[model samples]
Each structure stands twice: as C-alpha cells, then as structure tokens.
Target: MGKKSATVVLAHGAWADTSSWGKVVVLLQSDGINAVTFRLPLTSLADDVTALDKVLALVDGPVVLVGHAYAGAVIAATHSAKVRALVYIAGLAPDQGETVADVFNRYEHDEKAPKLAPGDDGLMWLAPEAFGIAFAQHASPEEQKALAAKQLPISPAAITVPVERPLWKDVPAWYLLAQHDHMIPEKTQRFMAERMNAHISAYPVDHLPSVTAPELVATVIVDAVRFVDG
Candidate 1:
C-alpha cells in the first residue's frame, strides 16, 4: 500500500455524525495532511469500536485518532499500534473499568446532558429539545433544526460500560477544553484533561468546536501532531 500516508481519523460524538466536522476537516487537509472523519454507529460501545477499527485498518501509515464526546471512549477502545496520537475534543477519556456515566456522576451528576433514555430497540436517543441547547447552540436556528431532525441515537449500554482498553495511557494525547461547552460542561472537560494528563489547549467555543471554531480547533489538532512529529 505504498508508504502509509500520515492520517488523522476523526470520530464524531453522539447526537451527531461525520458531517459535523465540516470545515475542521478541510482545514486539516489544507495543511497537506490526510484527514478522515468516520461516522460513528453510536449504537453501542462495541459497535463504535468495531467501526473505528475498520476505518483504522484502511489507513496506510501512522494515524492520530481524534474523538469528540462519546467517541473519545470509542477511540480509546479502538486504538492500534499504528496510531501515533489522540485528540479529545471536550469528550470522555475514560480509563479501563471507567464509564462515561461514572465520570459524569463523579464530577457533576446533575449537569444538563441530553435526556438519554433507552428505546424499545435497546438504544439511547436524545430528547428533541436537546438538539437546540445541548447539541447545536452554535448552529443557526434552521441548521439546528435540521441537525436535530437527523440526530443519531446512542445505546444506553455504551454510556455505562467502562472502556475495556484505554489507549490514552499509551498514546500521546491532546485535550481541547471548550470553555463554553454546554453539552459536556467546561469543568468536566478540564477534569478529563487532568486525568489524562493531556497536552492542553482551549477555545471559547461551544461543545461542537469543529463547527463554531474550526480554524482554531484544526490548529490545535495539527499542532499536537506536529509536536509529536518533532
């Protein structure tokens, strides 16, 4: 497969899809780096990890896996030796035997997250109103509506299951703390960074930095890669 191209595989968070990355991917590609954003199944932790592994297997060279929100846990479980680094964007970076729910309940149990309840199909979906405030406050009113209309449901099991493997302990990590993030409170992001002992950066953007501040977010991810490369 020729020389494996250096790549950055972006994993989107729950309640969103690969398209949520939008301009952030463009910015990374503009830097002469290969950037790929994969759609998360968001159905179960095992399913998300399997999907990421499939995407990683397609990559030719060293990779940096970037995960947002719940995909942070997804990346942790799907990590491979080919991956050079990890970037967590206001996401969960749970250790082995640690669940997102455990982290949330530890830090701020009452924090306002999307009302995630299980469905008859045994998956967790967000309440529609959460799309406007929790998921897409930065988007235009119409844009938010459109996103809410197509939001993917996550599995309740994914939230409560601890990562079977925690890659952050092995790989170089970059944590971008969103100061104004409502979905995964700013304090919670900082706490995760501290736990991971990650290379830290910050933005005043909301939970979805890829949409609100793509340039800055991309710079953070790129900078992390360059730091490791150097």
Candidate 2:
C-alpha cells in the first residue's frame, strides 16, 4: 500500500451531519491522511451537491471522496478533476434518469426497517425507536441516544431528484457493504456496487458502521486512499 497523501473528503448521509464521521476522521488523520467531512443541508440534492463541490474546490491535490448513504448521490454528482477516487460506505448510487428514490425502492423492503413519515414541512424523519431497532442496532444505548438527538430531518424532494451523471462512471470507486443494514437492504447495496464495478468490501456491520465500527470503516477508506495514491 502506498503512503497517505491524498485528501479524504467524507460526505454524510440523510438524517446525519458532519459529526457522523467523527471517529473515521480521527483515524484518517492519525494515519497522516488529510481528512475533512462535509455537512449536507438535507434540503435538496442540488444543494447538497453544491456544498460538496465547494469543499472539493478548497482541497489540494488528489482527493478520495467518501460518501455514506444519501451522500453517495451527492458525491457522485461532482465532476471535479481533483477527485481521483470515490468510496461508498453503505451509500446510495443512482444512475442517470433514475432518482435516489428509484434505486432505494428497487428491492423488497426489509421488515425490520423503520416506518418513515414526512411532516407538514415536507421533511422526513425516522421514528424515535428507529435509532436502536433499524438505523443502528449495533450501537450502544448512549451512542444510539446521541445519534437520535443529532438526527437531521431530510427533505422529501431530495430523493425524488434524478441524477444526471454519476461521477462513479468516471472515477475509480470502492464500496463498503453493510451486510446488516436495515435502512438500505444488503442486496440493493450489492447490486449498485456491482453495477458501478466498484472494489467492494463486505462487512457484517449495521447501517452506521462509521459509528459502530470505525476501525473497519477507516480501514476500507485508507485502503482506497492507498489505491488512489499508487
């Protein structure tokens, strides 16, 4: 593996903020990789992509853009030449003409998944009990509480927006499949990763592996950085 020199920009998914990548950031920096996390507003797809692009603009040299869940679509929307590679951590990767919702609803819904509902403001939020049962079953009681408290509501229109061109089509990509994910089915994840022809690392972790298994998440990201650096 090559030494760490590239910037690793992490994009968090829906119902999450930049703090979601906290542990992973620490690990990456400890390994001497320039790591930064982007905060998505969860308002609209275009808005999120613009936020990611701004972060990419400030980064120097080669970058390995990492996205978790919904942020996958955000990272894929970028056409930045500075981004040499892409990494998906149980992320959603939609193709041209297909909306994030289209790919998300492609498979049979998991029975254990949370019942999501939108508020009058057109924002969607997971049920309070969802944090422990569906979203992050492997997380501790305290960790789950923290996650629930910090949850960011997502706009319904964000998922409905279609992706024009996914950056994964041009950049080398890697995927870390969460086998125990309830938010996104494991089969759906595999299908998308295979379609993108991404180098995949399957793990027996839940949806929030970056929190429940930071070591594994950081390892996969570091490996992708090494590949890009080489």
Candidate 1 lDDT, 1-230, residue by residue in tens: 45554688999988888888878988988898888987887777888889899989988778888998888888888658888888998888877888987765555523556655688988777777776776767777887776777777787877888677688888879999888777777778888898888988987887788877788779878977786556
Model 1 residue runs over 4 Å out of place are 1-5, 109-112
In model 2, the runs with Cα more than 4 Å from the true position are 1-4
Best by TM-score: 2
Total clashing pairs in model 1:
1
Per-residue lDDT of candidate 2, residues 34-103 (tens digit): 8988679999998888898899899878999999999889899988998989999999999998999998
- Residue 98, model 2, lDDT: 94
**Residue 145 alpha-carbon offset, candidate 2, angstroms:** 0.7
TM-score of each: 0.91, 0.97
TM-score of 1: 0.91
